[model samples]
Target: MNDVYRIIVNHSQLISFWDFAEQPGQEAVAKGPFPYRLTEMAGPIERVEDGPFGAAAQVKLGQWWNLPRHACPELNFHGKDAKLTVLAWLKRENIPNRGCEAIAGIWNETEKKRQYCMFVNLNIWDSADQVCGHVSAVGGPTPGYKYCMTSAIGSTPIVKEEWHCVAFTYDGQYAKVYLDGVLDEREDFNPYLYDSGLFDGGDDGANFTVAAVHRSNEMGNFYTGAIGGLAVFKEALGEDELAELCKITV
Candidate 1:
């Protein structure tokens, strides 16, 4: 596994939105004309269109929507000893309840049956001030493996409507969570818990996804808010690499 981590997308990667925009005679009527100004960011994200309110849709905290899982596609990182890092800028809405909800994570889907391989859920148990990070192994009739870690940040909470940087890094042996460039929590799991070819192996057809799950109900307790700057790294980033990522003002 390489120690160097790199940013895959930063708004500068978006290309043309014409391909994703509704055409003259398409199966579905256009929701609204494509907002050319929005695509000016980086690479075009499919299924996303300019909303009446603005560019990407803004979701309130604790409010969950299934919508089109494809809107935010999966990001794939390949390597056995790989360290995966997911970072995003977000603003939490001050909802009456802070129920547990997944901020974002990777998942697997086949038809209607959806399985969450890993995710973050907040305000579990309706506490309105608690959060938990969970990672699962396998899915099916057999009991799928699940491990969880909790933190107290949910209480004081970062300001409700400010840009907050949240990041999670998982090496083969441990998973670390960071808040605004600061180490917050860590969980060590049995590396053997994963079966051969589970993550990047060709058999499982593994892929990375962003922002929410394909099935709305799956996000049950957690999932509400606006998210941006979603970036994935193939390798575990060192302290310096993480600092650089946080320093990016754009």
Candidate 2:
């Protein structure tokens, strides 16, 4: 057993897990301690070889997965001041457009609110014209998702047809995005500027969707790529460890 993950916290610190390894031919399944499931499949998230962790899953234009609401208790954060980390192995050889390429998120799109997310930006409306990672720690239960964002710190074209480890961290103090284990962008969290609740666990009625954010009624913003070993950790990882995490087992 991995003793590193056994730290007692009144609840399982590692909440969501989907390896796409043990389960083959099946459409969706949740292999974690919590009852979290990739129960919702918009398209066909096919299983492929040479996964980032063990085995990997791939998605195309309309392909996606989702976790039913309140299934992610770790997102709530409770009284814990530790950082929240999202790490995934991505291989996007093709992109539909220069809009928003969402990796994964704790978002409730129907209400136009997102708790937190890591995405690829083409700098459409902004001056920056590079393809970069966009990380956000958003606060909501209101009109739109209010957030402090950290963006743009890597090369363009976003690495095609290759396995790259992408990560984002929210340590209560700052938000940082990592590409291939390198810290690319960093921004501080602004709480005083917003007059809403900061961390309130999450919505019980919400759902965790992968590869798809359900951006509009047509269900656009779908990520056309492959992802392996998507995991959420309660604690933020150091730079060295983040680099090490990106290393694939050969």
Candidate 3:
């Protein structure tokens, strides 16, 4: 096993991990406990061999991966003390829309079932081309805003067509965004504070999605790029551990 995959699997709080090594006509299988599969949606995604983790999946506009909410119960993080982590290795690409790009999580703005999501260039608070960790306790837009404004945004813009490690962690009190395993500090944005906790979407929650999010009554905010790997943990990961993961190669 490679060091990257080994370290992720060894993490005690790991909920799911996907190396994006699946072949055509196969689902994106996940490792760790609750190893659910992500079915391709909208259209077929191309699998490329050149990747850091292993084979990578290239998702274009209108393409994404999906898993039903009922099947992945462990991913439904909620309550006042809810802690979570989401990590991804991606090669960014410029999309036609030039809007915010959604990486992963259970954020469905269409039905007001927003829990948590990892996004890039969120275009809020004067942010552009930066990693963003969005958290919502109300499962909807932040009060008095058209969209959720509570998020931890990194200062560094993720360059296009480069392999980068992006991650987010929420430890009940703060939401933090990491770029290439380092905390890309920003004034009051890198570690956004919100102590209210996550929202429990209950029986009618949004499905876990990758590369896109439901908004404006449809799936938008698509991330057009190559994804080498993705992982989720129930507990927030420390800086040292995330840095170690970023150091590993294929």
For TM-score, the strongest prediction is 3
lDDT by residue (93-202, candidate 1, tens digit) is 56654444455444443322222333333433333332233333332222432312222222224556555656656565445555565655323221213321223323
In model 3, pairs of residues that clash are none
RMSD of each: 9.5, 5.3, 1.4
Q: What is the lDDT of candidate 2?
A: 0.56
lDDT of 3 by residue, 174-227 (tens): 999999889889999888988999888999999999999999999999998899
Model 3 residue 220 distance off true place after TM-score fit, in angstroms? 0.7
- Candidate 1 similarity to native, TM-score: 0.52
Top of the candidates by lDDT: 3
How much is 62 displaced in model 3, in angstroms?
1.0
Q: Give the Å shift of residue 211 in candidate 1.
A: 3.3
Which model, 1 or 2, shows the larger TM-score? 2
Give the total clashing residue pairs for model 1: 20
Clashes of 2: 4
Instruction: List the candidate 2 regions with Cα displacement exceeding 4 Å.
Output: 1-13, 22-35, 77-82, 95-98, 122-157, 185-205
Predictions ranked by lDDT, top down? 3, 2, 1
Best-to-worst TM-score order:
3, 2, 1
